[model samples]
Target: MDSGELEHPPAEELQVGPILLALADDNRRRVVAELYERSDGERLCASFDLPVSKSSRTRHWRVLREAGLVHQRSIGNGLYMRLRKDDLESRFPGLIQAVVGAP
Candidate 1:
């Protein structure tokens, strides 16, 4: 793995507990919701207009990455992220839609 890349669990290793915990945060969920709407491509971490402090945003990203909900890679001076939608769907069918589409 590249040194600039963050560690992410294998798709089959995605557990419900971690995923639920990560999504429990409104900020993280908001990120996921926005990611859900995007096509399959990485977006810069700064692109999300999250209403949180830089430290908090970092924490949210860590949680999401650690939970295997997203994959993050550092490129140049920016961090890029992409939702692990396909992985999540494969591990827990319909979970992404259920979470992002929830009322």
Candidate 2:
């Protein structure tokens, strides 16, 4: 193995497969687009105008979080979610650009 591989956590290497799976869903793709293209910064779960119900929205966020596409932090009764831009950029170059830049 290359010495550079040692610098990344094993979990980091595992993110792509899950991220791809998460993006495969239409709702999850929309979620990513909203966060990546619309939101100015970290946003509450309730802020997104997703088509899904609240409970379903939570599940979607969980998928994104598990995929390492979003960073979720609990704040009181609400959860704040932000796109893992740096991680995604480093792991998959041009992906965010393609998704966000899509017309």
Candidate 3:
């Protein structure tokens, strides 16, 4: 399949329960915050500096992606992740802002 032709999962189909559970972790919350701080067009690679092991990092991102908090795509050998700001803001107003603001 052509890379441009691949479709990503819709935000509405995300599993809210699992997502909430994943976000309950401090490390996962930090990852979400980092993505939130980026510009709308920015993307974070899976190889970025994270405090967790490779397998655990994969789990964290998978939970976020499955929860609809982020969009993930395979680019060559790396997986790139981006925040689903619009969908999240619409679902829960000010939630992202509040989380980003929290100490």
Query: All models: lDDT?
Result: 0.90, 0.75, 0.73
Ranking by TM-score: 1, 3, 2
The best candidate by TM-score is 1
Of the pair 2 and 3, which is ahead by TM-score? Answer: 3
Writing each residue's lDDT as its tens digit, candidate 2 over 1-103 gives 5532212223356456777888888888877887886546478878888787889997898788777888777667777888878788888888866876665
Q: Estimate the Cα RMSD of every predicted model relative to the unseen true structure.
A: 1.2, 7.4, 3.0
Residues 27-92, model 1: lDDT tens digits: 999899998898874689998998889999999999999999999988889999999888888889
Model 3, which residues run further than 4 Å from truth? Answer: 1-9, 13-16
TM-score of each: 0.93, 0.78, 0.78
Model 3, CA-based lDDT: 0.73
Models ranked on lDDT:
1, 2, 3
Off by over 4 Å in 1: none
Model 3 lDDT tens row, 50-103: 787989887777777777777777767666788888887877677777876888
Lowest lDDT sum, 10 consecutive residues, model 2, at 2-11
